[model samples]
Target chain A: MSHIPLEEGVPGIRSLVMYRPDTGKPLYELAQVLLRDESPLSPAERELIATYVSHKNTCKFCASSHAAAARYLFDQESGVVDLVLDDYQSAPISDKLKALLTIAGRVQEDARTVSDEDVALARSFGANDRDIHDTVLIAATFCMFNRYVDGLATLTPTEDAAYAQMGERMGTIGYVLPQKPA
Target chain B: MSHIPLESHLPGITGLLEYRQDSAKPIRELTQLLLRGESTLTEAERELIATLVSSRNQCRFCTTAHKSAADILLGESETCEMVINDFESAPVGEKMKSLLAIAAHVQKNGKNVTEGDVIRARNCGATDREIHDTVLIAALFCLYNKYVDGMASFTPTDPAFYKKLGERITTVGYNRLPGGYDQLKTQS
Candidate 1:
């Protein structure tokens, strides 16, 4: 059973959102702008940023779902998302992304730890203001999402393939709230 | 020295938001809902949650601002200070302390929160909604603290300034605060 009386097996933030739609609406809107909508960072890259932070936080549901979205968005290779999460330093992603991920990693642990050198590094790699700003927000925001899901002890499917299926739906429908279990 | 070239010297997240109102509007709206919107948790308690998290994150600007707001709603200054320094010894009831303990754990690490914490809170008379609200408050401030300090925004120096601002907050309210932080310069 969840911390609250949620349904049997709604995973991650999904169940929590159903519990409180008032908070959920803004959280979804934030995600829509941060991950779904377009900007300097491609939607795939944004999802990857979220995926990386969720992975660092060790939230399985978030990491898996976002990796699937990233894989769906970027067709160059299937394993690329996993590869980058494991070792973004060596992964084939652009230097700009690597730099942004470095900052994201800091935000995951301690926001105060992000230094002038980190900002300079991203700039050196050609990440402009908006790119860096969105990356930090995505990483920081996922911390909240990851905690909200895990804090409440929401149920998440363990099978990695389940995330792929959910990811397909998310890719098609975006971050709309699903009906609560009856 | 922000990641973005935000111009305001105004303290805390305001400077960062001043750079981009498009991003700021929804965040502002969310805070309005969470902090000021009608809830089982009084606005004071919500602000207390926010203040406690900021103190843990060591974000001076937010700690000062929200603590003042908490004080205003609570109508007592020493209790607010005691809660921050040591809630166990503070005059607050056990239920509020239990909720604060959960919030503290959340500020430290989300994974640390366990079923036992909820059980303890329930034993102390916290409802499901109260427990849920505490978790959200802790988690949300984790986001806000980063938004404030992650970009190296200014921190106001005078304690009196925060007290005055706190007194005004009840009347003006969070929703009434400027949406476009870029225009903050002119208002200041």
Candidate 2:
């Protein structure tokens, strides 16, 4: 149950966003731009960044749903999503992505703790200014999102299929505002 | 200076926003809606929540910038300092204290905010909207604090800078600044 009365059966942030469309609209727009719109980062990589941060925050709904989306986006390389989630260091991904994820993890734990060495490491991996900036922003944004969903204690559906559908929708269509229940 | 090359004259989030206008657009709109949009919580109250969370996150740029905006909105009372230092002991009303408590918990970790905290806020005469907005405001600043600090963006040392910036926030709002980032360079 959510902290406030929300439309029944709607899950996670969708319910919360429906609860306040004024604030929700901007949030959705931000997500769409960050995850789907034109950027140096591919949609798969961006989704992975969001998933990585949410997993660190222990935000079950965000983690599961985003992980599913990352998997969908990764397609043939889908297995890497769980591998990175479990322990990114050993995950079979590009060194550049690993470096970026390292920075993202640091941002999740404590932004101030993300030292110069971290930025240098990402740059060494051929990450440009945009890459590093987007990675940090993505991580930071998810921190806000993770808290928003859990702070209200929104409903989290239990089944894997639920997340699979969410993952596919996010991977394909990107983020859009959840409409109010009719 | 930021971790990446940015307009040297601009400070904090202004420089970052300039760095990527595409992403910055939505972020700016969200800030406008969360902080300046119509709500039961006054702009001052919302700014207070942002200041408190930024202070806890130890993001000097965000803490100082928002604290100044909150001070101007609060006018003569200027309770932002005390509130940031210790909202629990601050002289704010029960409703505000309760909402700040919720905001504080959200700052530490979302799970830290228990159901009891929400109920207590309700008891303090906080409406659902107030509680909801408080959490969102706190959450939003967490993003801002991290974004500013994560990249090691510039943090102005002069108090005067914050004073003017604060005035700008209250007057100009988040959607559009008076002179925009390019003009911010000359102002300081």
Candidate 3:
């Protein structure tokens, strides 16, 4: 049971968002822009960053659903998503992405700890200002999202299929605010 | 002195928002809605929640900026500091104390907040909206703290700057930067 009364059968942040549409609208808009909009990073790469942060935060709902989304976006390259989640440093991805993930990981643990070297390292690997900015923002935003979902103890459906469908929706349609329950 | 080439003239989150206006739009709107928008929680109480979370995260810029806003909204300079230092004994209402307790739990880890905390807050007269907003505010500040510090954005040392910034946040609300980001750049 959630701490507050939320729409039943709605899962994760959806339930919380439906509970308060005014706040939810901006949150979903931010997610849509951050993940789905044009940037130096692909939609797949952006979703991977969100997944990595949620996984580190130990928010099962965010991690799993985002992981599924990342996988969906990755398509035939889906194995890279799991590889990055398992251990991004050892994963088979570009050095630039690895460097960005290093910075993202630091942001997850302690933002102050992300030193000048971290930024320089990412730059050395071909990451520009926009890339670094997007990576850090994505990581930071998910921290809030993870906390929001878990803080309320929102429902987390316990099945892979549910997450797969969520991934398809997120990957295909992007983030849309859930309507208020009728 | 930021990792990225943010506007040196601006300070803290101001510089970050200027760097990327597109993302900053929703972020600013969210802040305005959460802090200045309608809610059962008073503006003072909401600012206090943000301050406490930033203080816990140890982001000096966020802590001081929000502390100033909270102080002004509360009309008492000491309560914000008192709550940041030790809310358990701070001179606030029981309802605020309980909500702050829940905010504290969310700051450490959202899962740290238990049913007991929510029930206690309700018992202290906190509405579901208040509790919900409190958690969101706390969570939102966590993102802000990380965003400011992760990029190592500027942190003004002068107290006068924060005073003006606080007044701006309270009076004008958070939707737009004073004079807009472009005008700010030209002045500098």
Predicted structure with the largest lDDT when compared to the true one: 3
Which 10-residue span in candidate 1 chain A carries the lowest summed lDDT?
A: A1-10
Q: What is the interface RMSD of each candidate, in Å?
A: 1.3, 0.8, 0.6
lDDT (10s digit) by residue, model 3, range A1-182: 88899998999999998988889988998999899988999999999999999999999999999999999999999999888977888998999999999999999999999998999999998999999999999999999999899888899999999999999999998999878667
Model 3 clashes, total count = 0
lDDT of 3: 0.91
For candidate 3, write residues B38-120 as lDDT tens digits.
88788998999999999999999999999999989988899998999999999999999999998898887788899999999
**Which is the winner by DockQ between candidate 1 and candidate 3?**
3
- State the weakest 10-residue window (summed lDDT) of model 2 chain A: A172-181
CAPRI docking class of candidate 3: high
Error of 3 at A14 (Å): 0.6
Query: What would the per-residue lDDT of candidate 2 be over residues B136-172, giving only the tens digit for each residue?
Result: 8899999999999999998999999999989989998
Candidate 3 accuracy as TM-score: 0.98
lDDT by residue (tens digit), candidate 1, B1-188: 55567665456676666565666666767788888887777888888888888898888888899899888898888877888898888888888888888998888767778888889899999998898889888888888888777776677788876886677566666553645434446645
Superposition TM-score, candidate 2 onto the true structure:
0.98
lDDT of 2 at A109: 88
DockQ of model 1 vs. true complex: 0.70
